[model samples]
Target: MNDMDKTRLRINRSLILQEVRIEHVRDFLYQEGIISEEDMDRCGNVTKTPRERIACLLDLLPRRGPEAYKAFCSGLQETYPWVVEKLNSTPIPETQTKTLSSTVLPNKEMNTGETSERQRIREPYTELNHTVIKIVTRSEALNKYKDVVRALGVPQPDIDQIEYANFRDLQEQFYQCLLKWQSREGRNATVVRLIEVLREEDYNSVADKLDGYID
Candidate 1:
């Protein structure tokens, strides 16, 4: 089997799906015109867990053709706008620390004389320095990284094979693409962080490596 075939594997796919809420998906599909009200009634039954319902829908939708499949992904993006937003956005450079001028603080919190929660938090801000950060969401991380590929200028067709892929398969592809594009002209903090992720390293360790990049 070829590399793309390997990415289509269903192994461990449910690990991600098990965490999703099916109604959110059904609502999105319906809203996007991917499924009809009648279709929802038939497929949205509570008898199945959210994952199971989605599994069933996953099987059924593709039978309707590629256009329907694209609609499903679009609906999924709507169902979880946060995931899509994270992937779509560009990562800002790290290592610069400047205080929020209290302008950014909510008016009530401004006078509290604190850094204002995360506006002062150390850990999350530090990790942002690593351009090769792992996504917090487990199920969507591969696609989130796939979004990085979109930014990287050229995505091989294997990327498309995972458009509607289940989690584990996409996870495999995520690393594969990252490996192909990895810069070889000596490693920097960002590249190191990417290496850590490719090695399945934990985020905190990766974050610390990233912090070292701070200027």
Candidate 2:
């Protein structure tokens, strides 16, 4: 199959997964009597709706499914307005941290009215250093990396087709794209611009490269 076909198939698979998730939620809500059978059917068929029309609606209404669901639960809010408000108000929780402590004993006591030697020596700032170095984890980094990869139309191989060298090369190219994106201020550029860069970098040939890497 051609690259575009392969890409579309991957996308369709992802969409199917999303649809199944949505359907599960829909069925649960319906069974609970939160949504009528009619509404459930309408929401379930969302994938059949034209994406272009949905995109236009998103431009005008500015909402997502979860946001809409939350707004529906809010009772006081109008559907579209609540959806927009909830979407805008969605919160990303801060990362969690762990603290460690070490204790040191004094070798000698200080002179009169002075502190002990151990008291004089400041404790190493483990918490402070942890705070300073605190950043997104590898999994979070990879998640964000994959988002840009998908947006750029970079090819993704099935698990069985992935190989070490090809994965490394793809990662290197992704980092390069990230750096370029950062340097460009990552603003005002269209999705098409990012896709163009990926194409130029031959990231579109990822499947073939994976085969070569395995060989």
lDDT of 1 by residue, 25-116 (tens): 67765555455555577668878677777676655453332245345446657556653343234232232112233434564564475555
User: What does the lDDT read for residue 79 in candidate 1?
Assistant: 59
Residue range 64-99, candidate 2, lDDT tens digits: 211223322343233234333543354432321111
Local distance difference test scores for all models:
0.44, 0.33
Alpha carbon lDDT at 95, candidate 2: 24
Listed in order, each prediction's TM-score against the native is: 0.31, 0.20
Which regions of candidate 1 are displaced past 4 Å?
Answer: 1-12, 78-215
Name the lDDT value of residue 177 in candidate 2.
Answer: 41
Candidate 2, which segments miss by more than 4 Å at Cα?
Answer: 1-47, 51-137, 143-168, 186-215
- Count of backbone clashes, every candidate in sequence: 0, 0
Poorest 10 consecutive residues by lDDT, candidate 1: 1-10
